[model samples]
Structure formats: C-alpha cells, structure tokens
Target: MRQYSIADLESRLAPSPRMPVLFVGHGNPMHAISDNAFTREWSRIGADLPEAQAIVVISAHWLTPGSTHITDAPRNRVIYDFGGFPDALSRVPYPSEGDPVVARAIRQQFLDYEAQLDAQWGLDHGTWSVLVHLAPEPTVPVLQISLDYAMPLPELHATFARLRALRDRGVLFIGSGNIVHALGRARWEPHAQAWDWAVEFDRVTGDALRERRVDQLLDPFRTWDTARIAVPTDDHYRPMVAAMSLLDPDEDLSFFNEQIDMGSIGMRSFMTA
Candidate 1:
C-alpha cells in the first residue's frame, strides 16, 4: 500500500457537517456478512438518522497507545483480522473513502495528542460489520481514531471531550462494542440468557450512564461489580466508554436490539439525541 503523510492526505477531502452519536453493540464478526436481527437493528438505526457528511468510528478492535492513526488513502481495504470464519465472510467488502482533511481536523482537537497518518490500517471487522449495514453505499468519507489502551479513565474522558465538537460538524461518531462480552459463555441458545454477572454489570453500567456517573462508566473494569466477567478483556467494551463520554447528560437515550445473545453477551445498542 502507498503511504501518505498526514499533511498530504488532509488536502484531499472536505470538511464535515453536524451529526448524531451512536453506541452500537457490534457482536461477532459473522454478523457483518450475515442478515440477522442485530443487522436489522443496525439498518433501522441508519434509516432513522439524518444524512452525515463524514463518519468517525471508534472501534473496540483498533486499540493503540498515546497516538491515534488516520487513514489517508483513496481506497481503504477490508481487514479480515479474525480467523475460523467462512470464506464468504472474508469476501465481504465495504469500500469507503478515507478523509484525511477530517482526520487532521480531529487531530487538531487533541492539543497534546499525536495523530499519525497511516495508509496501512484498514477497516477491521469491528468497523465494517456495522458500517456495511449502516452505510451500505460506502460513499461517506470515513476515518478511525485509535483508542489508547494504556490511558487511564480521566485521560480517555478528556480525549472524548475533544471529539464532542465533531458532532456539531456533522461527523457521525460511532463506538462499536458489546456492553457485555464474554466469548466463553456464548452459546447457540434460542433466547438470550443473562448470566448473573452479565445482568448485574449491564444494569449497573446502564444506570451509571443514565445518571451521568462519568467516573464509574469510564473505568468499568475496576468499579463495576461484574467488571471481570462483563468485560474480561477491554477489546469490545472500551469503545463504549469513549462513546458514552461524548454523550450529553440531558439527551434522550434509546436502546436498540436490547437482549442477551447466547447466554452472556449483551446485544443492546444505544442512540443519544
């Protein structure tokens, strides 16, 4: 892949417009290519939203420390980062353009933050899975801001605060991750079962978010009762923390596809006004 500097790519794209915020519970990568209830909810959510100028997705799958990467290439590739999936899954493609101008603008928001321009980082399953359903045309200019896994709660919240300004510029911000993700517990059960730990954690996290308990929501791994089981790993849940931070306390929040998947995973998604 040809690489371009941050400055080189920023000159190619246009500025963004004001857009809404979304916290999607992007389950298994299989959902990306398959048509199911979760995919239907994603489609509905996209239909309900106003047109957006650009989209910035904070995916649970893309985690880095200190610096965030922005893609400046003309055509971004679909990254099949997962294994043990069917060949059909690997063939699914979402051909979205990269917006370097928006990427630079986002980098400017973080005063002390380092934003790198990379052509290598493509759309991971966390991003393409939901986006395939949300923006099927793939015409929208898209950029991904990496999540710094090493950063503490306070720093993460501060970073998201900078991103809140993008909402007014018509850049749809989406955090893709499940609220309750325990891969070991996922089964082929017909109805969603709320494991004792999963239920408690999801409920508490929901309450904390609704009540505007920023601190608790920021660091669920340590504060929540079922932190260990609910999260287990920071891969999926971390993006929600970033999305939740961008939310307005007074905005009306709604959950989509609210249910338990398998036995433990929480497939609940949220939209904030």
Candidate 2:
C-alpha cells in the first residue's frame, strides 16, 4: 500500500466534507474539571479542527456484553460512571444535543453488528471530560456508541470501519481510551515518572500507528511481553482499534499528548486525515 500525505488525503476527498478521525488517550477524570496542559491542547485542537456537522464518540467507559448501542436521544446528559472523584466533577455538565437522524443512520450502516438505538447511557468521562475542553459551548450534535465487550479485535475493527461512510458526510469520530492503562500498577503521586515497560509499549504503539500497521496492534499481549503490563484489560486498548479502523491506507497521521501519566497511563493520542 502507498502512504499518503495530508495533501494527498485532502485532494482524494475533494468536493466532499471529509473529517479526520481522532483517538484520545484520556488519562485522569480530574482533567475534566481542571485547566491543565491536556485540556488546553484539547481546546487548541477544537479551534484548529474542521467544523464538524455531527460528532460521534466511541468511549472505553461504555461497554456492553454482546451488543452495540448508539445514543439516539434528542439531548445528552452527563453520566458520572466513576466514583471517588471530586464533587466538582459530578457538578460539571456537558448537555450536548444528540441527532437521532445521524444515530439511526449509524445503526443502519453497521449491518454486520448487532447495533441498536439507545435512549439512555449518556456521555461518560471518556467523552465529556475531553469535550468540556474541546467544545466548551457544546452546540454540535453529539452521539456516543458502546463497544461490544465480547467481540474480538478483528471483528471490532470491521464493525467500526462501517462508520467510514460518514467521514465524507461531515461526521467527526473520536475514540477515547488509553493505549497503556495499567491502573492497578500506577503510581498515585503527581510527579511520578513512567515505567520502562509502559514507555516501551507506548513507543511500539506509536510506531505501528505511524507506519499504518494497525494489524500489529490487534494482539499486543501476544506480540510483546510488555503489553501484558500496559494493557491488562481490553477496554482502553479497544478504542484505539476502533479509531484506527476509520483510517484508510493512504491517510496522513499525527500524534499529540505523547506522554505517560501516573507512571502507567499512556496519554498518546493521534489524528488521521
């Protein structure tokens, strides 16, 4: 396959409003209500990104057993799925409106999966935390799609690829999850440095993303021993797969927030145009 630059990707999608896809490794829930470096970058990204007609977020926080669900409500409410966080986080609201039309369209497009329209399960920290900085006013229609926890990485990739049709339709997709999220092994201090294995896993993931070898990421636990420590669970790692599935062989990719947090969480994020 031939690699394409940003210009080539833009030229190929000529006359159509093609939107780039993003994968954000949202680390701490505190970033939602706090004004930090990550949040500031999210704001800058919001300003620099192309104006999207609608936004769809595939968050790691929303996981279903055997079926996928898409938010179809007219309006979205914040779902504080996490606990032990500050009270301020609970008070923060993102009330982004939802587009049933677009949500229904997504359901129809994902014919290979058991996709269903859902009225409940609002935006989780994986979404609103970033959106609170990305789109402060939150006027755009936003939708959240659930990940089928039982699906394999390959099937999840194909299921998410179905959304590629919406790229030219002015829909922006955001996959929110961490590449390395070993929460149990994290150092809780503020000045903690990343572990060696965590850094190595992140580097490997970055290499795969830059070279467009997304297949290399499907089973990191089997490929690298470090992955067992970096990705003990699939929840966070799966969102990266979902985001990668949206990219074609000829798109330009760029990284952001390339750092590990609390010695474990890899906050490396990327965008494919």
Candidate 3:
C-alpha cells in the first residue's frame, strides 16, 4: 500500500499548536491498580500535560444507538461495566468533577442535532482504568461521549474533526481502547506469545496512524485479513478514528507501550503533539 508522511500533516497543521490527543490502549482492567510500564507511562504523560479546561474522552465501553451523549453529572459514579473481574477492581475510586461548561459547549457545537445530556452515565472501566494511573488526583473536570456507529460514515468523521478544535482551547480529548482486542481468543499470561494476526493488525494500525491514512483505517479489513479478526466488532476500534481525526499532519506523534498484552490484544498507544 502507498504511504503518506508527516509532511502531509505538517502542511495541514493550524497556526496555533493544538492540544495533544492521547490514544491509550487500555487492555486488562487489572492495570488500573498495577504499577506496570503502561500505567507508569500514563503517570508520566499526565505530569507533562498542559493545563486543560476540561477533559473529553471517548471510551470503547460507552455505546449508544442513533444519538451521541456526554456525561452531565456533577460528580460521576464510577461504573463497574466489566464482569467477572475481581471485586477489588470495583472498589477503585476516581472522584473527578464533571464540567457543565464543556458539556454545554459540546451541545452547542453539535447544535443541529439534539445531543443528549446524560446524568445517569458516569465513568466506565474504559475511562477509569486508565485515568486511575494517568491522572491519579485529576482535579480537571471530565466528561465522556458515547460512540454511535449508526451515524453515516461521512458524518462520523466530520464530527470527530470538529472536536479536534477543542485542543486549541486546552480541552483534552482522550481515546481509550486497544488497537486489537479480541477477548474470546486472549491469552491469560502476561508474557504469552502474541498471535501472528494480532501483531500484523497492530503494525498496520500504527503505520496508518503515522501517515494519517483515515480511509485505510476506517476500512482496514479490505487489505489485511487480520483486520477482520482484530476488529470483529468496532467498538474498540472506532474511538481511534475519533481520536486521530484531530491530529495535524505536521505535528509529532509519539507511541508508548508498543506491545500486545494478551495474545489477541495489541496494547499499542500514540499521542499527537
């Protein structure tokens, strides 16, 4: 396949430096409390971040149909969305405030559509698992937007691009999901050998991101057989599109924890500078 380069994005970068978008590949929920390299990197990144107005996250765990919504609660209750995990994982706390200001701004931005204000919704495992390490004592207000695959392909990409502007305003946009996540085929061992298909899909994903090839990403399965196995369902993959949409061609992209955790899940992550 033909490749695009940073020169392509550099030409498209805005005059002002945009806020960095961090795409975190949050694999096992156990990492939330563990002091692994992934969590350590999260801690380092959090310390280096610019002061932000509010945080906006797109998590694989949050799914809704037809409409998109953002959390609007004052203090969100951590949602133990996963099953069969140890009871200790559920007891973890992430008592962060929700920003009504950013929530209203998002509603106004998508003014044409009635974006729902969700009070019942709160931080899911996708968000908290990483946030526990990224921002242990996050004083910054946080909000989450549900992923709606029902939107037309064109509209889905366009909306994500709109949110990219939030970076200039000091609003952090985080996408928390793995590059390759096939739970049914995962190896429970930390050092288990990665499946060949998982490794292939993960490499393609990183190459596509560095080149800003959204077309290949949106329809990854066309070329790579591993794509189908990697993304049997796209709940974990779509957030990547939304997160990478805002990245300018010229800005630097850095990746950390560039390895697969389980045999089936690639825990590769990147940030757009």
Task: Highest lDDT: give the candidate number.
Answer: 2
Off by over 4 Å in 2: 1-15
Cα distance off (Å), candidate 1, residue 226? 1.3
**Candidate lDDT values, in order:** 0.79, 0.87, 0.81
- Highest TM-score: give the candidate number: 2
After superposition, the stretches of candidate 3 with alpha carbons farther than 4 Å from their true spots are: 1-17, 152-154
> Better model by lDDT, 1 or 2?
2
Could you tell which candidate, 1 or 3, scores higher by TM-score?
3
Q: How good is model 2 by TM-score?
A: 0.93
Per-residue lDDT tens digits of candidate 2, residues 1-273? Answer: 233354543442334478999999899999998887788888899888887878899999999989999998889988998899889989998878996777767776787566988998789989999998888886679999999999999889989998898888778899999999999999998879999999999998899889987667887877788998899998999999999999988998999999999999999999974
**Deviation in Å, model 1, residue 189 alpha carbon:** 4.4
Give every collision pair in model 1.
17-169, 17-170, 18-169, 18-170, 19-170
The lDDT-based order of candidates, best leading, equals: 2, 3, 1
Q: What is the lDDT of candidate 2?
A: 0.87
> Which 10 consecutive positions of candidate 3 have the poorest summed lDDT?
6-15
Ranking of all candidate structures by their TM-score, best first: 2, 3, 1
Score residue 127 of candidate 1 by CA lDDT: 92
